[model samples]
Target: MQKIGILGGGQLGRMLLQAAANYPVETYVLENDEQAPAAHLCHHFTKGDIKDYDAVYNFGRRLDALTIEIENVNVDALEALEKEGITVIPRPAVLRTIRNKALQKNYYTTHQIPTSEYILTHNIQELSEQTHFFPAVHKIAEGGYDGRGVQIIETEKDLSKGFDTLSVLEKMVNVEKEIALMIAISQTGEIAIYPPVQMVFDKALNLLDFQLCPAELPERTYWKAEAIALATVKNFNSPGIFAVELFVTPDGDVLVNETAPRVHNSGHHTIEAHYSSQFDMVWRILLNYPLGSTEAIMPSVMLNILGSEGHSGPACYEGLNEMLKIENAFFHLYGKKQTKPGRKMGHVTVISQERADLLYKANKIKHGLSVITKADGRSG
Candidate 1:
């Protein structure tokens, strides 16, 4: 069996482990946490920080090929691994570009990809004097995820509240809807694209609240989103999954929002709804195998279950059985140790032929569900 190495061991790594089962391949996952989700499933679980050069270098040194579930890992190690005769899918150069938000935006500018207008902010005074100051979004150049490290500068009050840290300020364009295209590039330079999915965010933090696949978008916008996504992959010369997120502007234009160089939250719906899941896609792509057909097996709506306010401990799920009673509602729990406010604990994917109806049904059950607590003594 061919052995491959995986960096990071959150749910994406865990899901990849599940998918690699079909090929009966031996897998190794390097993770900082011993309680990481993929620990037991992988043939070898090396406990090490992904951002440490020695850890990443040692893991890649022994594998046939290496891939990552997250981009925050040490890129220098990937570059070293590339030099040490290890295959680093999607290429370290691409990962390095996407790892930092500033570098990512610069790549788009260089490639002539359409995106929202942005200005890099180095200090508080600089952020204050910006022309597009009001109603702009503030995003850190690195280490931001799941509603953290991002701020919408709707008012002067927001900027004064400590949201101005190493931020990139951009015009908050009018968006009709938020959408994402989950794409895969194989080592042989083959590509596979999943149907675009419309995302519904929690108004407060911009955290993904729910997503419906095959976004109810016009044919033109659909093709445009796909084109932008493909263009990004081509430019990167990557050989792994790329999740290209976009915004459908109110004026019927699809604008590139951002990109993830690895398995992403936007593509989580593919697990139950697609012919090939992202996990399987990643494994196959890393092995230089033929990519799977990126067809939607069923209409699906996925809901992200975030920890409610005033909660900060292990995850507690409610109404999971209730959702399961409704035909094909599948719940995925990301065995996280804490459930702090806005933390991603897990997600529930409700699949059915009648997508609209299923969405409403799932919403109802989701309302009954609470990853939160009702003044419980134990943190949920």
Candidate 2:
């Protein structure tokens, strides 16, 4: 069987490994934590930092192919592996560009991809000089993910919150709706696109709260969103699954927000709602198999299960049994042993034919489940 290794062992890696059971491949994971979410699921697990050049290089050299669960990995090592004929999905060059926010923004401009306006800042002082660019979002150039490297600079008064390193200051869009489109490209140049999904964020935490597949969009706006998303990913010219997050303005214009080059939370509902899940699509691309169908088996809503506030210890699930009793509801915990405020502990996907039914079940799951610590119980 062909051997493949994945970098990072978070929930994304865990889910990817879960999907690997049906394939004829030996899986390996490289991560520093011996008890990482994916460690036990893979055939082999190496406890090493994914960002260390030597660790990543040595781990990948023995594998036939390699992919990533996160973006902060060692790109130099991936480049070296590619040179030695080890397949690196999406190409190292793509990762290099996507890893840095400034480079990623410049790439959008250079390629004529529709995106928000922005200014690149080398430091806080440079960012201060862009006072006219107030009410913009400040995003650090590298090593930022899941709302950590991003800050809203509403005015000069909020300047202190900006990053002191290289960053991107993007003018915020007059967003009416947020949408995500999942696209997969094969090595042979074939493409498969999943239906767009509407995303709702927990504004306070800057994390996804819930999302509905086959987003509610006017015919014209849907086509526009699709065209823009297609253009954005096609410019990358690489073979891998991509999640293109986008903004729909009141004027019906669609603009690219950001892109993730792997299986993403936005597509998590695909596991139970689509004929081929995002994880399955990634395997097909790596194995050179024909792309699977992206058609949804039913309309679905997915809610993120986050740790309750004031909880920080061994994980506990409240009302899990009640959630399990709900028909057509799928619960997936990340296997994380600890609970911290705002941590993504799991997700629940509810599928139904009627939009009303989907929303009702989603709300039930959202209010019924909580990830907490037994000592703290459910905090206010």
Question: What's each prediction's clash count?
Answer: 1, 0
Best by lDDT: 2
Query: Which pairs of residues collide in model 2?
Result: none
Relative to the true structure, candidate 1 reaches a TM of 0.95
RMSD of 1: 1.8
After superposition, candidate 2 runs with Cα above 4 Å error: 376-380
Model 2 per-residue lDDT at 174: 93
RMSD to truth, every model: 1.8, 1.8
Q: Residue by residue across 1-380, what tens digits does model 2's lDDT show?
A: 99999999999999999899989999999999988889899999999999999999999999999999998999999999999999999788889988898999998889988899999998999999999878899999999988799999999999999999999999988999999999999989899999999999988889988999989999999999888888888988899999999999999989898988888999999999999999999999998899999999999999999998988988899889888999989999988898899999999899999999888988898888898888655432
Worst 10 residues of 1 by lDDT: 371-380
Residue 195 of model 2 has an lDDT of 98
lDDT of each: 0.83, 0.92
Q: Per-prediction TM-score, please? A: 0.95, 0.98
